[model samples]
Target: MNWTWFHKLGSPKWFFLWSKSYALPLFFLGSVALVVGLIWGLAFTPADYLQGNSFRIIYIHVPVAILAQSCYLGLGFSGLIFLIWQMKIAPIFIQSIAPIGAVMALIALVSGAVWGKPTWGTWWVWDARLTSVLVLFLLYMGIIGLKNALDDVALANKSVAVIGAVGLINLPIIKYSVIWWNTLHQGATFTLTEKPAMAAEMWIPLLISVIGMYCLVASLVLWRMQSIILEREHRSNWVKQEVMNNGF
Candidate 1:
């Protein structure tokens, strides 16, 4: 196969057309998986002996927490792409992903607080894990604010890229927060190197939820990126024609 096709990825029109074909299917599959996972987790999975039904929040909390951090990494990597090759889609991807990551971080923080309230006897803590996650959320907000604060798209992209890159310093902190400090937050319950501490009944649904959340994140990012592409390319003839034909 020729490598020439890779270069064409810079074209917004190509990505727009290609994404349209798969977006609906991805969205549908993500929805089905998320629904099945949530139902199984919330209703079918046995509760933890220690935490009881409150542990069920893990299905949401864990997935969102993982996605929140991973999405920031993604934005940072996209920024690298923008800085290196100057791909037109890179900044759009960063912009599209920021809000989603912020929302995921918020969900994780809230769910963690709720879970903490009953399990730890408190709603908030200054523990390293909690503090680092909060910092990640703030970084996401700063990126979003930078994007909106600038009127020039090019300038906004550069600014946010710099901010996102700087935020990478916190990613390692979030990952090692539990290990580095004695905190209320527990170590990873799931890992590839070791068997899950939880039983199969609980682990399976949690796994499904994690996978489903990833799918949902991908679908949302792609959809949002498409919208960004349309906005940026609105003046282009092809984009105008595509939008008109699609009844947009």
Candidate 2:
């Protein structure tokens, strides 16, 4: 395969065209996966021995939490791509993904609080995992704010790229928070290095949920990136022609 094709991805017009060809199918598949996973996990999965049905919240909460953290790393990687290769699409991707990531982080925090209330007898705690998650949410807000504060797109992108790169220091803290401190939050339920503690009946649905959530996130990000491309390339002839031809 010619590596030169990779450089073509830098063009907004090229990405827009490519996304148009595949977005519909990807969206359909992602939506189906999410719906099936949610139903299976919430209804079909067996209740935990200790937490009972309340543990079902993990189907929603854990996936969003994992994606929230992973999205930040993705944003930082986009920033690195922008800074190193100067790809025009890189900043747009970061911009497009930020709001979705923020919403996911917020959802994770809210769901975690709700779940914590029943299990821990409190809606809020200063535990390491919880606090780090809150900080992650704040970081998302900061990046969004920084992006909007600047009038020039390039300048805004540069500023947020710096912020995204810097904020990555929190990722490890968030991951190890439970272990590093005596937090109420439990350690990881699944790990590559160790066997799963939960039975297959419980873990299978969780795994399905995780995979579904990733697909959902990918679909959303791709859709948003296409929108960003449209907005950024609005004045360009190719975009105008493409929009006119597609009736967009």
Candidate 3:
């Protein structure tokens, strides 16, 4: 198979054009998946025998929680790639993803708290998993802050990448906190090596929600990357022509 396209991603023009073609489709598809998953989970699936209606929140909670961690993982990886290859798009991608990841982290924390009030009878706690996830949110904020604090674009990218890579040390702590210590937070509901703890009726829709959330993240990042590219490439003839053509 041809691998030439991989190197072409280093070109802003190549990425910008391709992203415009795919981003909207991904955004629309994710919206459809989310709507279908929400309806299926909230209206059709049976409530947990124990938690009752509050369990419905999992449709939103699980996917965002997963996305929160996964986004950090992506950030960390993007950091590594930037530090090594110095790819122009690498830092832009990280910059594009950080705010979205932070929002997902916030949603996950709020949703977890909401679910907890019913299940664990508390709105907040200092449990390991909870604490680690909180730190994860802060890390996202730190990356965003670092990016803005620097005056030089190269320095900003380097700072953001370093902070992102360092903060990645928290991902494992968050994932394993349930097993490492006694916490009110539940263990894995879905695992690759084993079937989900919940019935298929419940989990299938949850899985769909996860897929939709991932698509939504991709769409957001792609759109954001385009904006960053245009700003960074403003002096280029391609960007000038594209901007003129778009009347922006």
Predicted model with the maximum lDDT: 3
Please provide the root mean square deviation of candidate 3 (C-alpha atoms, Å). 1.8
Residue 4 in candidate 1, Cα distance off native in Å? 3.5
Instruction: Give the distance in Å from residue 124's predicted Cα in candidate 1 to where it truly belongs.
Output: 1.0
Per-residue lDDT for 158-195 in model 1, tens only? 88877777666656765576447655657777789998
Instruction: Give residue 111's lDDT in candidate 1 (0 to 100).
Output: 90
Model 3, which residues run further than 4 Å from truth? 173-184, 246-248
Predicted structure 2: clash tally: 0
Cα lDDT listed for each candidate: 0.84, 0.82, 0.85
Worst 10-residue lDDT window for candidate 3 reads: 177-186
Collision pairs in model 3: none
TM-score of each: 0.93, 0.93, 0.93
Give the residue spans of candidate 2 off by over 4 A. 173-179
When sorted by lDDT, best at the front, the candidate numbers are 3, 1, 2
lDDT of 2: 0.82
